[model samples]
Target chain A: MIRLRAKISSSRGQSTNISHKVGTWSFSAFVILLLTVIFFPGLFAPYDPLELDVINRLQAPSKAHLFGTDEGGRDIFSRVLYGTKDSVGASMVIVLMASGTGTILGAIAGWFGGRIDFYLMRMVDVFLSFPYLVLAMALAASLGRDMRSAILALILVWWPSYARMVRGQVLSIKERLFIRAARTVGASNFQILFWHIIPHTYRTVGVRASMDVGYVLISLTGLSFLGLGAQNPSPEWGLMISNARSYVLASWWYSVFPGIAILLVVSLFIYAADRFSGAER
Target chain B: MAQLLQILDVNKTFKSGNSKVKACQEINLTIGEGEVVGLVGESGSGKSTLANLVLGLEKLDSGSIKFEGVELEKLLKDKSKSFRREVQAVFQHPLLSLDSRKTIAWSIAEPLVINKIGNSASRKARVLELLAAVALDEGTASKYPSQLSGGQLQRVNIARALALEPKLIICDEPVSALDVSVQAQIVNLFLDIQKRLGVAMLFISHDLAVVRHISDRIAVMYAGKIMEIGDTDDICESPIHPYTQALLSASTFTEESDEGREKLKLFRREEVPQKGCPFSTRCPHAIALCREEEIKIQSFASNQESSCLRAQEIFPNLAKK
Candidate 1:
C-alpha cells in the first residue's frame, strides 16, 4: 500500500515537471518574438508607425487595420511594435546602469567597511525609504518631462535595492576561506575585491538583475502614462494608452492592444526571471 | 642556521562582552632556515593563533614578530610583495582554501600572477611545473576545486603555497581534516616538499604522532602555553612535562588497564586558573605552589625547555641523560 502511494506521488511530480518544461519553452519563444519586434518592427508591422491619416482617425479594428487607428490615425499594431524598442529597451538600459552602479558601490562599501560603509549604506537607506514611483515621478518631473529624465530617475531609484543586495553578498563572500587564501597569495585589496569577491556575487546579482528588468518596465510605462516619460506622438505604449483614454468607450482597440503588449512583455520577463533563479538553485 | 622567522613574546587576547580569552600569551619561538618545527597542542591551545600572527593575518596585541630580521608590522604596512612571496600558508580545510569558481591552474598561478613574475604563457608553463611537483596530472589543472578529492585539493594548496618558492610555509593542521589513510600520504608529501624545496615550516596539529613523524623539533602546548619544546626524539622519548607525557601516551594505543589509563589522563575537574601555569589545574602532580606562582618556560638543556614547575623532580634523569 505504501509503495502504491509513493508511485502515485512520483507520477504526479513527473507530470508537473513536464508542464514546467513546456511553460519554460513557450515563455522563451514569446521572449524571442518580442525581441524580433523590438529589433525589426518593420518585419511584422504593415503600416509605418509615424504615418499620419487624419481622415481615418479612431477607426475600429477591421481587415485593413488589424489593430485599428489611433487619435492621430497611426496604426496601433505598428506603434506597439515600434514602441517595444523605446519602452522595453529603456528598461533594459536602466537595469544595466543601475546594477553596474550598485555592484561597484556595494563591493567597495563591503570591502572597506568602516566609515565608507556607514555613510554609503545610510545614503542607500535614504533612497530606499521613499516609495520608488513617487520619488521617480518627482525626480522625472523636476528633471523636465522627457523619456531620458524618466529613465535617469528610475535608474537612480532602482539601484539602492541592488546595492543593498550586492553588499550583503559581498559581506558573506569576503568571509569565505578562499578570500583569506587569496590574501595569502599577495593579492592587493583591489585585486581581491574585483577578482575574488565580485565574481562570487555574479549569480545572485544576475538573478536579481533579470527580475528587476520586469519591475523597471512597469515603472517606466507608468511614468510615460503620466506624461513624465515619452511625450505625445512618440508611439510609446503608455503614451498611446493615455491618448486613447478619451476614446476608450468608442474605440476600445486603441487602448486594449497596447495594454496587452505591456502585459505580455512584463509578465513574460518576470516569469523567465522566476525560472532562471529557480534553475540556479 | 640563520633565523628565517622569530616570534618574540607575542600576545593576543579576544574579548567577548566582559570576558577575555588569551589565545596566545608571551609566545616566543623561532624557525631557522629550512627547519620544520612541529607545534602540537589540543584544540584552543593557540597553535593556529601563532600561525596567524606569523602570517600577519591577525593584529598582535603585544610584542613583535620578525621575519628575515625585519619587523612583520613594517613589512605588512609597506605591503611588501617580497614578504608575501617569502611566507605562505596551507589551511586545514583543503577545499575551502581554493576559490571554487576558479580552475586549479588559475588558483596555483594566482601568486605568480599577483607578483608579476611571468606572462600568461610562462605562467601556464609554471602552473604545469607546479602540478608536476605536487604529483597532480596536467589535466587536473583545468578542473574546478569541487571536482577534486580532499587529498588532491590539498596537493593543489601545497602547490599554490610553493608557487612563489616561499622561504616558509605555515601548515596549520593541514592533514587533520583528511582520512587517516590519506593523512599519511599528505604528510609524506609535506616531507617530500620540505626535502626537495628546503622551505622552512611551522607545522601545527593536535595529533602528536603526525607531528612527530615529520617535525625536526617539537613544541607541546597546553592551554595557550608551551608546556615543553625540544628535539622531536628528546620530547617524545623523555617528555619532562606531565602534559607532554599525557599527549604522547594518548596518541599511542596501549593495552593498559582502566586505572593505569586514569593515571595517564591529563584533565582534571578543577577550574583553569586565571594566572600562573595554565596546566596547573589539569596537572596530575599539581601542588599548592603550582597555582600560586607565575610560570615561565625555562631552559633545561641546550635544546630542551619546559614550563612545568616539577620538570626536574618528575624526570630527574632528564638532565643527566
Candidate 2:
C-alpha cells in the first residue's frame, strides 16, 4: 500500500504526501477504523475480551453479545478489537522491513549492475524458489510461534518480492537520460543513484508494494491460523480464527466475525492503495 | 587555447545475440575553445551515442578522446572533478532531464550542490542568476518541473548546465522536443549565452537550419561515421557531400518555393541495408564503385572534409550558390 504512494511521487514525496492524499478519505476510513480499534477498543467492544464465562460459551448472536460468545466464552467482537493491533502490526512490520530492504537492495543492484546484479538477483531467485508458506512456517516453528517470530519469518519470506520489484524499477530508471545528466553534472555515483535514479523507480515499486499489503495481510492470517502467529488468547484475527474453528459449525460467529474483520481491514488498505495511486502527480 | 577536445580513430560496436550494431567507427573530430560544433544526423546515426561518449558516460571500444591533450578516459579514471565540472550536457527532453518533484531552484542549483561549489547562500544566488539568464522569472524558482511548460523546463535544463559554468555543453537535440515556435527562442538564447560566456558547445540536431544558424562548424554524421564536416557556410552554401546536400535541401522543404519543392526529392532507402558504405543504400547517385568498399574522408576546401568519393567527379566545378 505504501508502494502505491511511492509510485506516484518520484522523490521526496514520501510519507507527508501520502497523508495529504490519504487524509482525504483514508483518515476517515482506514485511520479512523484502526484508531477506534487501537485507542477506543472498549467503545466498539462492549464486553470484556478476556473474562471467561464458560456457562455462556457457544451462545448465539444476541443484543448483549453482538458477535456471540466463543468456545472459551470470550466475546468474539471484543477479542477482535484487541487483536487488531497484532494482525495489523505484523503486516506493517513485514511490509516495512521487506519493502525498505527490498528497495535499497534493488536500487543498489540496479544502479551498480554487473556482478552485484548477478549475485543479488541469484539470491532473490534462490529465496523465491522456496515456497513462501513452507519457508515462513519452518522459520516460525523453529524460532517459536510468537508475534516477533512470525514477523521475522514473514519478512524473510516477503522481502525478495519487493527487492525484485524495486530492482526492476531501478533498472528502468537508471537507463533514463536524466541519470546520465546527473553524472555529466559531476554527481557522484551515490548521489546519482539516491537522488536521481532510485526516486524515479518509486512509482512502479509503490504500485506493486501497495497491492502486496493485501497479500501480506492474508499470509499473516494464514500463519496465525496454523498456530505460528499471534498465539491463543491474543485478539489477532488469525489466532482468533484458530481458537474458534472447532466451534464454527455450532457458532459461526466465532470464525465468521474475525474473518469479516480481516476482510474489512484488508479491503480498506486495498481501496486506499487504489485511491492513493489515483492521486499521482 | 589548444583544441578544447579531440576525438581520433574512435569505434564502437554493440553485440546482440548473433548480430552486431556498429554504432560508431573511426570517427574523428575536434572542437576548439569557444567553438560551437553542430553534429547533425538522423536518428539511429549514433549521435546520442557520440554525445554519451563525449560525456564519459560510455567507454570507447577503441581509439581515444582527449581534452586539452589529456586522455578523456584517464581523466575519468583519475575521477577528475574539473574535467567533469568543465563538461555538461543538455538532453533532448526537457521534463525528463529535470527531476519532476524537485523545485526549479533545486534543479538549477543541483550541479553547484553536487560539486559542493559554494555555500547555500551563494548557491541560492547562482540559482537566481541562472534563472535570470535563462529568462525565467524569479517566481518560477518556487515551482516544480511539472508546473512548467516544455520550453520553460528546457530553459531550466540549460540553466542547470550553466550552473557549473562548464567549458563545454553537449546539447543533444535540446530543442527538438520543443514546438517549432519555441525552438527559435531557445536557439537564440543559446547563441546569446555562447557569445556572452564564450563556452564551447556541441549542439546536436537533425534540423539543418537550426544547426546552421548557431554552429560555427557543422559535422554531418551518417551511420556511425562523419561523412562531412566544415565551416557552416562551406557546408551550407556549397555543400560538397551528397548527404550534406540532401540534408540541407530537405530541411528547407517546407519553404513555399520551387527550389524548396525540388529539394524534397529523396532516394528510396532501406531502413538498414547489409552494406559497407553507410550512405550507399540511400545515395541517389551511388555507382558500382561507391558500393564496392568503405570510403575514407576526402579533403576539400580549407577546414573541410567529405567522405563522399565522387565529390571531385560529381561536383568538381559546383560553385557556391
Show how many residue pairs clash in every candidate, following the order shown: 0, 7
lDDT of 1 by residue, B1-321 (tens): 999999999999989999888898888888999999999999988999889888888999999999999999898877557889999999999999999999999999999989999899999999999999989999999999988999999999999999999999999999999999999999999999999989999999999989998999998877677888899989888788899888877775334555565447766546568977888888888888898899988887747999888888888776732
lDDT of each: 0.89, 0.84
lDDT of 2 by residue, A1-281 (tens): 78886676656656556665663466257656775677678877788788999999888888888888888788887888877778875686688788888888888988899999999999999899999989999999999988889889988989898888888878777777677778888889889878877777677667656667777888899999998888767788988888877877877888999899889878877777776666654
Write down the RMSD of all candidates, one decimal each.
3.5, 6.1
Q: CA shift at B242, candidate 1, in angstroms?
A: 0.7
Report lDDT (Cα) of residue B236, candidate 2.
85
Give the per-residue lDDT digits (tens) of candidate 1, residues A201-260.
887888788778888998999999999999977888888888889998999999999999
Q: For every model shown, what is its TM-score relative to the native structure?
A: 0.93, 0.84
Candidate 1 overall Cα lDDT vs. reference?
0.89
Off by over 4 Å in 1: A1-33, B253-263, B269-271
Candidate 2 local lDDT, B1-321, one digit each (tens): 569999998999888999988889899999999999999999889898898898898888999999888899778867558888899899999988887767889888888988888999999999999999999999999998888999999999999999989899999999999999999999999999999999999999988889988999999998888999899989887778889888877776334676525563657777655555678878887888888877888776566888888887778774322
